[model samples]
Target: MSLFKKFPFKDKPSTAAITCIHILDEKKTILYVSHDADDGCWQFLCGKEHNIEDSRVVSLQQIYEIDKSIKKIANLEYGKCAYRKYKNSKWNVQ
Candidate 1:
């Protein structure tokens, strides 16, 4: 028997998971959010919609619980950042 018969995924993923990012200001106000599917290459706050079997809320709540009260800014926030995502299925794709 072929292992393909026992596994759901074939050689590659059949769907692509989509996510959005929202950035907040000093007053916890959302300044920018992802508007399109290919809106990358910017100082963005990341967020993802999880599929948990619970409440009827489709879109997962994103609360950036960070202690932004400290006024700590010398020259920059960080050094390098790599933008990547995990493997998962799409929203409405089988």
Candidate 2:
């Protein structure tokens, strides 16, 4: 039997996971993560949406949650895929 068959997998609709990196004039970058809400998980400013524009909106929301003073420097789309797992811990980008 294939190893893939050993574990149950459910096919679900995929959503685009948007991430934004805020650049500062001081040559410092800010990556936002909700420590209180996310339980100390480190991640970039991110959200889920169906399209690039919608994803940008979601990313804006995420950014505001961290700091309203931070303006958007740029936006980039990483396409759509399942959440990457980190061993038995929290999810991470692959």
Candidate 3:
């Protein structure tokens, strides 16, 4: 059996999502996940204050690879977001 299950995000693996350099640098795990209603774009954030220039656009697959826990909210609806207190914490939907 496959070790990882595929998520049904609206975008493809190659599709881009907004993220922080901290996540890409492995400095922090994603603490906030947002699915945009206007464009269906996703955002994986570290839940910290970062400069606008610190934002980066990375593929959805890349973000998934970074934090598999996000898969729990893969079915999150548009305009919705999920957050957690820590890496292993339960996601709180908003």
Candidate 4:
């Protein structure tokens, strides 16, 4: 059986997404997620700011590997954002 529930987002598993390189750091976790309304692009990020070079384009599935809790925000509305204080914290949509 799968460790996590299947993704609920409309985007495909191979869909391109923008994520901060910090997400690759062992000590860092994805605390924020955004679904742009204008272009319907997805962005996964840590709560803090990062340099332009810190950004990376990765498949949505790759991100799911980093933090499966993100599945909770898959249905988040366009133009909205979701954030949480910690990896295990409940996500708060904004």
Candidate 5:
């Protein structure tokens, strides 16, 4: 099988990931993104479930579009909307 055939987001048995969600109304959404203590750029939603309800699966499954590989796309879109709003100081420019 081709290397690309592997699921991008599948965590290996040794690697632990926590997944979360980011809900956006206008822009600058509530990103359930995480960061390591040292480097902060590689942020991602926590990807593991501790329990049924006490988990972020609800949010993850609700994302509109995009695949897990570029999950951050949604977050970035929200951030862009937020920036536009903040820059213009309004959700609608009128």
Candidate 6:
């Protein structure tokens, strides 16, 4: 059984596990990775969860490669509805 199977949102077989982190700097600026440099859109560092571990190794590794000084301020997970909204409104903005 998958570790996330206990979570309410994990009931759907197609529900992908995503690890997201809010990276903050000393100046209080939030880090967002752009889909394309010229696209003028940005979002937090996130990765698909493929393992049972909670360390979010893949997402953390991507973030650390960008800036070692960036600290994790928050960790959040969105349900289907909220995630859809985010993907449509925030993430898809160009």
Q: Highest lDDT: which candidate?
A: 3
- Clashing residue pairs in candidate 1 (N, C-alpha, C atoms within 3 angstroms): none
TM-score of each model, paired residue for residue: 0.16, 0.18, 0.88, 0.88, 0.23, 0.19
Which whole-number lDDT from 0 to 100 does residue 62 have in model 1? 22
Give the alpha-carbon lDDT of every model.
Answer: 0.24, 0.29, 0.88, 0.86, 0.31, 0.30
lDDT of 1 by residue, 1-94 (tens): 7533432322122222223322223332322222122432122233333243211211212222221211111111233222323212111110
Model 3 Cα lDDT, one tens digit per residue, 59-94: 898888888788899889999999999999999999
**Tens digits of lDDT, candidate 2, 1-94:** 9633332212111222234432222222333333222322223342322243322223333433344332221122233122322212333322
lDDT of 6 by residue, 1-94 (tens): 7634422321232322223433322222222333223432223343333233422223333443444332222122221111213222332222
Question: Model 1: how far is 63 from its true place, Å?
Answer: 3.9
Q: In candidate 3, which residue pairs clash?
A: none
Q: What is the C-alpha lDDT profile of model 5 across 12-92, one tens digit per residue? A: 222333333322222233333442334322233322333434333322333322223343232332223211222223222
Residue 90 accuracy (lDDT) in model 6:
38
Q: Give the TM-score of candidate 5.
A: 0.23
Q: Which of candidates 1 and 4 reaches a greater lDDT?
A: 4
Least well predicted 10-residue stretch by lDDT in candidate 4: 1-10
TM-score attained by model 4: 0.88
| Residue-level error in angstroms, candidate 3, position 65 | 0.6
Runs with alpha carbons beyond 4 Å of true place in candidate 1:
1-26, 39-60, 64-94
Tell me the spans in candidate 6 whose CA falls farther than 4 Å from its real position. 1-30, 33-59, 79-94
